[model samples]
Target: MTTIPVTDLLGSLRSGNSTAPRLTWYGPDSERVELSGRVLDNWVAKTSNLLQDELDAEPGMRLRLALPAHWKALVWALAGWQVGLETVLDGGPADFLATDDPAGAVEQHDAVIAVALPALAMRWTGELPAGCFDYAADVRSHGDVFMPHSDPDPSACAVRTQEGRIIRHRELISGFALPHTEGARLHIPADKGLESALANALGAWQQDGSVVLTHPDVALTGKLLADERIHGS
Candidate 1:
């Protein structure tokens, strides 16, 4: 398998099917959020800009995601990769942390981002800890396009798993363990956890495919499967 750079994969997503929905989320309370390729790229760009501009993130640094397997978490993972930050999924020391619990995360890291998981959240509902950035509030103010200060080193670590496994940037695509389904719409259950969901989503996107990610509480009904044109779980 050919190794596709994370940067190139993101570019392909933006240019290949700019208007089609690449990631579709089905959450509790009948919530459905769909992000077209262009929109998804814009979100990622804004997030990458935020990480670079606001957080002063650099390549080879670590950004730990204390978030669940939600759409926003997926976006954060992609953005972290775009910024060349080693995305840490484990509870290890990191330069920055993105979490739903701002107060708790602030205690662990100096630079913390409070991420709201709700689809329509404009900002964190409550008061954030001192110095903790509000993801929903701050992300929109960033630029829609991102220009990284430096290219990621392919040999540098890209992801650190909870099980203490490391995956390098060059190995991210080629080393993806999921079964590839070309141009297929895959259904990913959120119950499998963040790392699995991220891997599955990456695998789907790499093949010019799409994903229908469902929250744990959301049932995968027959109508949803048919409506989403899901090829596999």
Candidate 2:
């Protein structure tokens, strides 16, 4: 698939080839959830719709992301990028933000989105600030397909890295490790950050591969690999 621009990768996932397993995330408790490219795209769409309809996310908007290395974080990251917003990972200034602690970030950003990190949490049981919006509750009611009013510039800034420098989608896409085209199943250590997770999953998807994500507690042995039919780590 062509991946010069970042949206091309998203386009391929949405329509070009949507039925394959694109990402499989595992929690620390051994719980797992496999998302096909279509399902993943649907999540991105819902998140994008929420960001746009509720938070006024638009091209060039600054979005601060304070999420952990979890599956929902991936959805937020992709959705933010899909809306042509700059992801501020360094806790810098932004127009909108996503964090577990919405109270702290609400003062800085226009709207604060609170994401419950628990695997099966339908909503946050903790007491949230009055202005905070639950990501789980808000995202579920949005549309499943994203149809942008205008295509964003591929050369536009996509992310502000930890070092506080802007990076484009093409630059990020070029850094991936694209392998063969077979449906390769990968088993990965689950301790990596959200950034690493995105890179690893994107690299694997470039090869038409799936993943078997797990925490360190889950020992990855050959027997386990054979049982899961995983081809790589």
TM-score of each predicted structure versus truth: 0.96, 0.86
Name the regions of candidate 1 deviating beyond 4 angstroms: 1-4
RMSD of each: 2.2, 3.0
lDDT string for model 1 (1-233, tens) is: 22327888888989997899899999999999999889999999999999999989998999999998999999999999988889998889999999997775677775999999999999999898888999999999999998888777888899999998999988888875365778979888999999999998889888898899999999898999999998655
Candidate 2: C-alpha lDDT: 0.74
lDDT tens digits, residue span 1-233, model 2: 22335466667776756887777776656677878888988988999989888787787788887877667877888888888788778778888878876766666668888998776788987788878889877788899877775566667778887776777766656643334446677766757665666666667666667666676566777887786787645
Residue pairs with backbone atoms closer than 3 Å in model 1 (clashes):
none
Q: Rate the local accuracy (lDDT) of all candidates.
A: 0.89, 0.74
